[model samples]
Target: MHDESEVAVLRYGHRPGRDDRMTTHVGLTARALGADRVIFPDNASQSEETVEDITGRFGGQFAVERTAALDGTISEWEGVIVHLTMYGERIQDVEAEVRRAHRDEPVLVVVGGEKVPFEVYEAADWNVGVTNQPHSEVAGLAVFLDRLFEGRELEQEWPDADRRVLPQASGKRVVDADAFGDGDDPGGTDADGGANDVTE
Candidate 1:
């Protein structure tokens, strides 16, 4: 359902119960941070539902999918593969190259849930680390995507949204996203990698 060349997230792992919220945030981060889609393991149905439900209300073309062959998805990706891991090359050293490559090919971003298999490291075109320090994969992914887009994702406009948040110095206020009838604006979100102050 997607073109071979697009920026997508491959949620490489999931641990039931223990990781439900985390896994769900991974998908949400992928959407809010500029990925076109996220591929989850078939067993992560709850996370998938929550992410999709938010998308339905917030409005965007972000896609959430499931696959049984997570490894095959990596092996068969038609474009560049990026695996985010603390052990890999620092993002500072390679964001330019990855961003340049992304202009020409699809990018599959892999975020690990537990201990990632070694083969995933070998298959990646670039194994990126936001920092050498240990941190949450959600934090790592957010940093990388921000650098990848050079911060353009922050200004993302959500079209066809049910609500639009007004940025304010204080207090919360929301307006219908379709108030303008263009379906091209929305409230900034508190969801995942969204711009801060969703309803100020």
Candidate 2:
């Protein structure tokens, strides 16, 4: 199995009103899609809190951290730095090479939230573009992660969740830990429905 922790995401240049929601989605997507952690280098506290809440409720080892010096952080990260941009090599063409090269090393995927500096482009070990067109950063990140994990992320089990959503064709059907049979209950709920409280 590919260790999701091998991949991390860095959201650079966060602006308050402008990039708030987008940056939050970037961090959430990174965690949900199988990244070890996310680094918000421009002080996205709200986003950090939301991600923390989600991880706390759902049970994940994923992490989120805020910092001010993104360039300096990237400079010190002991892994490959991949910047997602529109002006770089196509993701499909370079993903294979990237996987082979970083097979045994960690990967830090950089997603820009605002106008990026020229130094960022130079700092990256690989500048990858999902498409050479205007697109959502969230979409690019999801696609990149999907490619990197080769769809394994979709099958990942959330063992710590109090309530889990079952795959459905239409309507929503969430399975609380209390609903499962003894052997099936990963959360070890009792017959009295001793499941963890589903918080807001």
Candidate 3:
């Protein structure tokens, strides 16, 4: 089994209002996609408590940190650093090599919200691009993570989750642990024999 904690993300920028939502989504995506943690620089607008709340509600023992020295932190990390950028080498070409080279070490993937510095590229053990076109950072991170895990991330189970969404053909079903049990097949159909909407 692959250790999801071996992979981490560094969100390089976080501007209020503009980047608050995007950055929060970045952290959430990373957590959902099996990343161990996300580090936000001191310039970030989101609070550590908010991230803590997310992890508490979700089901991972994930971590979130705010740092003042982004470069210094990267330099001190005892692992390979991979910077995602459109200007970098194609992901398909470099991803395999990067995985092989750092198979035993942790990986720190950097996603920038603003124009990254030249030094960051130089500091990266591998600079990879999902696509050489303008794209959403959230999408790029998701794709890169999916590729890195070879789709195994999707199969992960949140054993500690207080709530979970049951698979349905149509409509939505959210089950709270407090209101359901293992033998209880809470999934029910509507009058049309299709998935029914369950409201609190």
Candidate 4:
């Protein structure tokens, strides 16, 4: 439905111990949900590694980066900046407009933590709220991307994947990409607890 114009996610503010998994999910969500890349805060190297590791096994062209210049990144960003917040304008009202604008330009989506600085609100081309209520940034981001792509991401194929999940009506089943031969599923990573969908 759209041309390639790069959709990137930037996570702002992080408390190492408190936000470890939350921050990691932000990157993972971005990668799985069709964003081209995710940029983590400088102190989030561990999160970067975790996201990269997932991409390696599950497969995609997703990239993970870390930056110390967050403020500058937003202020100097070349394309639209969307900041997700509970206090912002409702997402349903603005997603169509955001989608049109993003068609020809890169979109940098900002997901903040407990307290986003005032400058972010001002710098944003759009201050969007998935729901104007309390919730996780990961939820907000996931919903936003699904809407942005109009559910096309669910049909996305992962290239160069070492493993992939075969959808089942009941129990989980994962398979090695190359080992499926003669109608036999000889390889399995689901034993390692890898499933056929996004990690929750």
RMSD of each: 4.5, 5.5, 5.2, 2.4
Write out the backbone clash pairs for model 1: 164-187, 165-187, 171-200
Q: State in Å the error of residue 22, model 1.
A: 0.5
The worst-scoring run of ten residues by lDDT in candidate 2 lies at: 191-200
Name the runs in model 3 displaced over 4 angstroms. 1-5, 45-50, 178-200
As for candidate 3, its clashing pairs are none
Candidate 1's TM-score:
0.87
The residue-level lDDT of candidate 2 at 157 comes to 68
Which of the two candidates, 2 or 4, achieves a greater TM-score against the reference?
A: 4
Please write out the lDDT profile of model 3 over residues 114-186, one tens digit for every residue: 7788889999998888999988898899998888877888888765655556776767565654545564534
Report the C-alpha lDDT of model 4 over 62-150, residue by residue, as the tens digit: 99999999998898899999999999999899999998988888999999965898999999999998889998899999999999888
lDDT of 4: 0.85
Give each model a TM-score: 0.87, 0.86, 0.84, 0.91
lDDT of each: 0.84, 0.78, 0.75, 0.85
Show model 2 residue runs off by greater than 4 Å: 1-5, 178-200
Top of the candidates by lDDT: 4
Candidate 2 lDDT over 82-169, as tens digits, reads 9999888999999997787567788989998889899989999889999999888889999998888888877776666665655547
Off by over 4 Å in 1: 1-5, 180-200
**TM-score, cand. 2:** 0.86
* lDDT value, residue 11 of candidate 4: 96
